[model samples]
Target: MLEKLPLGRPEIVVENGKQTTVAHSLKLKSAHIDDRLLPLLPTAMDAEQMRQRLAEHFREHLPNFEFKLSECHIRQVYYHPEKQCGVNYRLVFDNGNGTVFHEWLYGLMIPQGSATGRFERAAKRVKTSRVVQPFLQDFPPVSQLDDLQMILWLFPHDPKMKRMPDAVDPDFMKSQINEHAALLLDLPEAEARNWHCD
Candidate 1:
């Protein structure tokens, strides 16, 4: 299931399926290909462990790739009526922008043509879009989203390293993400055509 981005419950998983959307909004339900799936995050013991897992996972998953998590700052503890206790990890990274890993999984999901062209089209469709077209490429996996307040790659809850895999399903992931999106945006579906996955 798509847990809240970054700091939400790490139980959401993304597997192969068709377009999955929340009932009210168009947030990405789990997308599928060949009944296979992309992965999702799982719980971490703590911030330190989470950091270790994600750092290594990226290196192993990408070739000739090196990303560092710097500016390791933290937000003051805050509580969400919904999130219970939510904390923000402030960090910067070197992004191949999932360019290598994306091709390895799904041929570059970013749309073709001028990135501006794609963004313009996508922005027109997504009502929640505040600025110009936010093409999946314009934002990429690294660009920050005003709504998500995240770069998307910061949380790698699931690992290729884990012995026992823990995955959340499409339906569950969609529900969680949709719920979170609505809570965050007060809009139904703000998902763009292309996914800015990490």
Candidate 2:
């Protein structure tokens, strides 16, 4: 099946007035082309889009919980060639009775020559680590000793497909949601309070 895919053009490099054609071949693992798993894959999205999607996902799975999204600003953390960028944004969940859980979410930006892409990526990377670190004392807890935890980082679109890789499984997503929901629901009020933002 992989062999049926079209090949890309050879890369040509010119150095010192000499042109060289370098052959390139497509190398794909079996999982990459698995037809059975393609429908379950996630599409690539930017940071803000990811945040909204995640909030929706959580709401769909755990309808009883209240989820809120906010931007976390960090000052002078990331210095891009074009502009300064912060690191991350945040998602806060509450039971509407003062028990809240905070998760710092950020997207890993693909390094690019474009100034806009460069700045956006740099901002999210820095915001998650720099700003969240001081307030929580440990932005990402070293141990999973509690229910409250930071969500996973988001990734940008694949340059080729313009979306995420096909490896993301719906079952895996469901499991993650279930695990986190269970942990959050089981957390004691005192412990949950500790996870609240200010």
Best of the candidates, lDDT: 2
Instruction: Please state every model's RMSD to the true fold in angstroms.
Output: 19.5, 21.5
lDDT of 2: 0.33
Q: Per-prediction count of colliding residue pairs?
A: 14, 7
Cα distance off (Å), candidate 1, residue 65:
2.0
Q: What is the overall TM-score of model 2 with all chains considered together?
A: 0.24
Tens-digit lDDT track of model 2 for 23-53: 2332222322222222211121223454565
Query: Which ranges of candidate 1 are over 4 A from the true structure?
Result: 1-46, 60-62, 81-84, 92-198
- Alpha carbon lDDT at 56, candidate 2: 60
Candidate 2: lDDT of 152? 30
**Local accuracy of candidate 1 as per-residue lDDT tens digits, 13-38:** 22224432332211123332121111
Candidate 1 lDDT trough over 10 residues, lowest sum: 102-111
The TM-scores of all predictions, comma-separated, are 0.23, 0.24
CA-lDDT, candidates in order:
0.30, 0.33
